[model samples]
Target: MVFFGKKSPITGKQNARKTTGLKAASTRSIINKYHQLNKRKLQLQGLKKRMKKAEEQAKEAEIDAEITQIDSEMEKLGGLEVYQKASLKGQDQTRGGDSSHVLLKWLKNEGNELALEEGQEKKLLEVGCLSVSNAVSKSTEFDTIDRIDLRSNDPLIKQQDFLKRPLPKSDQEKYHVISLSLVLNFVPVTADRGKMLQLTTKFLHPQGLLFFVLPKACVENSRYLDGELFDSIMASLGYEKLEETTTDKLIYQLWRCRQEKAKYQKFTKNEVRSGSTRNNFCITL
Candidate 1:
């Protein structure tokens, strides 16, 4: 004899729940790609150390090929979330308030010294401006401000990589002010940071001001720079420090370009040995 069983009333609801679970799992897998890429990078670093210890050229060559493959894969995956986390953490710790507030305060206190023409339209360029909420954009002191970033999709922000592309020749030395807030520390290499600074110098007028904000740890722990070393490097780049303020978390400085001809020079042991004529200068390293 054949028997017939009743259909479960919750069959449709069970199917819907399965569909939702699959979608959530897919989304999580995409996010986990970044974490996986980071792990692979660390593994590559270990391989490099092993390659150094290897006495055979063939073994070292094999490791090098492996590293190249991993790096290419990582590049295809795009920017990692770990870098974004570090940048956001540094931004949160910045003490003098938001970028807009600090800029406004500086203008209120030091605008007269700038000798800017009354009612003239001032130009400002803000690099690594992840959003349009910059001080120059918010304040009435400037008529034109360009905010550039790589990750933002907002139409107001220029979606371009500052390091990879060159600014228009016509824009060179056209800005009256340039602001760099928590941008330098993201550069993985010291040479790259110097390159960024050189690019910044091109965008400012001869007497224009640079408003720089950086994490305090950059000066304290970075292999490339400290407070005094940074100041010397700026001097070599023709920037004269006009004002500086510091907090436990961040350092803010206003520097005026002394000459248009000054170029970026990397700090070196020989340069230190030459002795800095600038007063109150000392290199801890």
Candidate 2:
């Protein structure tokens, strides 16, 4: 509900922050622009590395200048954390859907079928949590709902990176479920995506559930990922896919931790799917 009063690029004035919400196109444009700038920054950095090795001092300097400019623009957009908050706004009920809301409804309908111990309370760890009152937070299904994000806008959500979260001292400290909706794709490093998946297993109890979600384009339209490859990746990490739901915009999946110790397999960034305009999304394990 807070606005930083960031100026509108189109109007050259403070964008009227409305509680109602932005036009769908306007919201989408902001998100797309952020992605374009981020991708360009990475591309330029790669080119600069090559230029430095070739002794092209002048070209490298030019790249640095571009990088500095990009950094300024990144600040103007309020960086990834702020951009994510903006995206969350777009997912508000007024705008059509909140992913957590759907997750809550799905869980409620399938509550009886979940692998939970009779009369025992379950705990959940929600990574990339942005709000204190998200649907899952209000649900009674979980006795404890621990929320964390890279940065905190509210006191309720711990301001810590999930990757750096301390190891649990006992089984009680581990969670029965872990949620990572719309989280993995935001990780800037491709390899870290795999690492994050690996670390989630350590934070969950035996037979724990993992709720993972991503933009459909990540697996459906990317150059290096597909349904089969994604399944294999999860299987290699000792997770058995329990549920999968696909929509025009996103893919939601539930995976159960399994002790398939002998089934572990190494994965790499290979071109499993390809097309000229497909996105370059891949996980290296």
lDDT per model, in order?
Answer: 0.58, 0.75
Model 1's TM-score against the true structure: 0.63
Query: Residue pairs in steric clash, candidate 2?
Result: none
Candidate 1 stretches greater than 4 Å from native: 1-96, 111-120, 171-173, 222-224, 260-266, 269-285
The digit string of per-residue lDDT tens for model 1 on 1-285 reads: 111121321111111111122333333343244434444455455555655443743465554565565454444433443233333333332323465557667766754245355555688887777556544566688778888776654688787777876665773336788888777654544456677777677777667888888767556555445677888778878888887888776788888887754655656532322223322112221
Q: Which residue pairs in candidate 1 collide?
A: 100-135
